[model samples]
Target: MFLADAGVPTVSWNLLADLQEMWAYPFMVNAFRAGAIVSVVCAVVGWFMVLRRQTFAGHTLSVAAFPGASLAILLGVSTSLGYFGFCVAAALLIAALGRKGRDAGAEESAVTGTVQAFALASGYLFISLYKGLLEGPTALLFGSFLGITTGQVTLLAIVGAVLLAVLALIGRPLLFATVDPEVAAGRGVPVRLLSTVFLVLLGAATAEASQITGTLLVFALMVIPAATAQQLTARPGRSLALAVLIGFASCWLGLIAAYYQPYPLGFFVTTIAFTGYVLAHLGRAVHDALGRSRPRGRTPLSIGGAA
Candidate 1:
């Protein structure tokens, strides 16, 4: 009945009316606002993470947010506090343990894996210790947009703004360091400090995104869009813009789908994001194949004929 009234098209189509209906509900409005902010922040931060090959570290920080949220519930505090605290601590810890330079890839992975393991275990422990309802556990893992408050939306916007501002300030130097650490270091770029700062920023972004997509599905918001953009473009600025655009589209579409369907927002968001990524890869593969098949330079006989 509501869907019909919203002009969602059972047998007929009404795009403007459908959009107006979706925007009519306050909760949906808040959801869209929150989703937009989360998408942009995650896209920007995830772009740099992909460039630096720090997906593992991003995953670890996201996982660590689970323990933080659970612990916050146990202590009866705001879950956001827990998310930020745990993620930032984990980021600093990872930075401290993996400071042996970029060449120490194995060591960094080991450190990240260890942190992820402990964080998961600790999250379960917190869950076990909680005597209240188990619903919070599910929400922490899968996420919900139905009951999102205006305050939460405002908070998301604030955090997104700050993260973007910081990224703008250090984006160039960080890109330089990520591309060639040895050369960047030789040029006095404060490679280690920038790395540490970037990790902390990643943690912050992970924590913020977890609030929307949940800890388990953080990659949906952070990784997929950025990876898709990278697959589609080699230019950094264009890639970043494309990543943000993809993220925004995924979030909006996912929210609309979740509004009509009885499913977790994270599931919809992740599926949409994954679909975009797959399409990007397919397009790239087709383009590469076509390029290879096209003959480059004229053959000797053709050149002689032309002469």
Candidate 2:
């Protein structure tokens, strides 16, 4: 009868109304706030992580967070503390080992793999020690929206602020080092110190991002948006800003979709971000192909990221 009435709005209108109702709940409100914070933090740190080709390191840190949160459950301590502690510790270890490793690229992969394996083992051990309680680690691994509290939102904001500040202090030198470490070192930039500092920042960022995206889905928020933005632009400033926009949109939209649907938030977030990346890649490929017919030779891709 309600559907038959002329006064009744369409399904789209019902969806809009439901969205408003979604905000009425405190948990949903907190989830949105937390998602925004996580998106921004992940975008900034992740932009640099991708630029430096340290995606493996970032993945290792995310894996490391699993054990940290699990251990916290075992000890009945705050999971955030465990997350930050283990991630930072892993970052330091990776940094230290990278310096001593024979081939920089190959060693980074080996070290990251080793760390990831150990972390997963420790996580399983802790989860097993937790007796019959499964929800704590499950939330850390898969994410939970309704469990997000106002205090967690505030903490994410504060951590995000500190991370951004530190990045601002080191961004220029870090970028130079990332682009050409030997040249940056010749120009008097402390390449090694900056590498260590950046790794720590990456760890913190991974931990913060995991709160929203979960450890397994951290790449959705941290890498996919940043990578997509980089693919679309060579200018560093535009790329960073675009990454933040993409991440925020993905996170927010994912949250909204998860609210209305019966599926997982991480799945929606990953799907949305991945879809954007694939579209960008296809558009760029098509554009290049069309441009190539005008010239006898293939058009060259831009290798250097412009300031």
Which one is best on lDDT? 1
Q: What TM-score goes with each of the models?
A: 0.93, 0.90
Please write out the lDDT profile of model 2 over residues 41-101, one tens digit for every residue. Answer: 8999999999999999999999999999889878998888888999999999998887432
- 87-151 per-residue lDDT for model 1 (tens digits): 99999999899847545789889999999999999999999999884688878988878767898
Pairs of residues clashing in candidate 1: none
Q: How close is candidate 1 to the true structure, as a TM-score?
A: 0.93
Residue pairs in steric clash, candidate 2? none
Residue 72 deviation, candidate 1, in Å? Answer: 1.2
Off by over 4 Å in 2: 1-16, 100-102, 295-307
